[model samples]
Target: MTTALVTGPTSGLGRQFAIQLAAAGHDLILVSRDETRLTELSMELSESYGTDSEIIPTDLSDRDQLAVVEARLADP
Candidate 1:
């Protein structure tokens, strides 16, 4: 299965992207600033679409957290 790592997925375009990507049969790695929203969305997407969804609550504006995210993506 293909995986998509989507940043800022707790609201707006990012939220929609997560939903759509889940619907499209992609496993999702959802990143957002809101932990509650991220958990909620992860549950909703997993239940509704029968797809795996992982949440990483992160503030991308922070350089350290952004580096972590980049490292995760770059992992083999």
Candidate 2:
């Protein structure tokens, strides 16, 4: 089971990437500042492709928040 981490998944290319990855049977770790959009994308992927996603509402420009994402990736 491959998992993809996608940033800025609320619109444009990032949203398309999430959908394409889900179609390819990849689970997701979606990162964005907008929790509402992230949750919406998560549910859409789950319903459309049986994809499971963990959404992290994060502003990556902030050092602390970037560290959080870095930690998850490092440990995973």
Which one is best on lDDT?
A: 2
Clash count, predicted structure 2: 0
- The segments of candidate 2 whose C-alpha lies over 4 angstroms from its true place after superposition are none
TM-scores of all predicted structures: 0.92, 0.96
Cα error of candidate 2 at position 5, Å: 0.6
lDDT of 2 by residue, 41-61 (tens): 999999999999999999999
Provide the overall lDDT of each model, using Cα atoms, as 2-decimal numbers.
0.90, 0.97
lDDT of 1 by residue, 1-76 (tens): 9999998888889989999999999999988889999999999999999999877888999999989888888883
